[model samples]
Target: MTELQSTAFVSEDKFAVAQVALYILAVLQVVAAVMLATGGAPIPFPQQATAMQRLSGTVNAVVMVLAFAVVYCLLARCLRRPTKLVWRIALGTFLTNFGMVVLTMVAQPGPSPVLTGCLCFAGIVSVLRGCKSVKAYSHS
Candidate 1:
């Protein structure tokens, strides 16, 4: 490879951890959905829960799982190409996720939520920095 090409090539090793992180989030979402759908008993529901509340929670869980799956796919794509588009997708995903975490913490404070938000913020910085090292190849 030419020196220019060598310098432009973004190391995949940098983003490998990001892909693994995405997988962890996806797995968590799937597990949460499964647990909620299976029993809805995981969380205490006072005397009883209305059908609407149960349905709403189940649907929400399913949506979260689906969203995470999409983000995971983007991360995989980024690992493969490290292109600008993939980096944008990763940035957008983490930005929204970080926003949600902040909102959740503000509305209802929790240790776990805080930790998750910090982790997501870190992921965003990691990806943005990694993206700086990549440039789409141009064949002349």
Candidate 2:
């Protein structure tokens, strides 16, 4: 294959990896959201043992699920068309994941804090790689 064709192939592969990571992150977020809403061991630090807490937890859970759905849709689109819009969506996902890590650290200390932090970092790296791939492919 030509150099430009090779670059395009590599870009597609990178986007595939990123899409997989996004799906994994979405699943993780859904799990976390469930735990938050259920008053599980990993409940948020900002939460209290009150009706308000329960309500807030439910809201948080809903938001998490909705966010995951949106990300999944964006990932599908990105896979179909790896363009600027795709990179923007990936960046948004990275930022949102980062925000979740911060919120988790601030709201409560948990056994999985390290894991959560790592996951957020992974998301950031994946996003950066995907963006770079897109840029390289475009230039090629």
Candidate 3:
């Protein structure tokens, strides 16, 4: 094999863990989408949500779309090239998703506290994984 080809393969190894992190974030995004789409249950929201709350939901939806795009890009790059840039994208996705989760909890009622708590916990996982991936790639 050519030297450049061999070097490319070697460098790809550094990003294997990051690829896993990105895929995990993608799965979490899907989970969040399901929760938001289904309403998570039927939390009573006092006749109608206020304008601010409605705006928040709209924003959350937009964030989710962005998260999905990040996931797609990260996954594609990780699968195709496995570079540090892909890891950075995954980390960004995690932060965005976490922010959306927090916003949801603050702006809307969970079907129950338990559901919201579960989402928060999931968000924590994504954040932790993202951080770990960043550290791992940075060192490599």
Q: Which of the numbered candidates is closest to the native, going by highest lDDT?
A: 1
Tens-place lDDT per residue, model 1, 7-44, is 56544355655666676666656666677678742645
Runs of candidate 1 exceeding 4 Å displacement: 1-12, 39-64, 136-140
- TM-score-best of 1 and 2: 1
Tens-digit lDDT track of model 3 for 84-107: 565455455546655666777688
Worst 10 residues of 1 by lDDT: 131-140
Please list the residue runs of candidate 3 whose C-alpha ends up more than 4 Å from where it truly belongs after superposition: 1-12, 41-47, 50-66, 69-79, 82-140
**lDDT (CA) per prediction:** 0.69, 0.67, 0.55
Residue pairs with backbone overlap in model 3: none
TM-score of each: 0.67, 0.57, 0.39
Alpha-carbon lDDT of model 1: 0.69
Per-prediction tally of clashes: 0, 0, 0
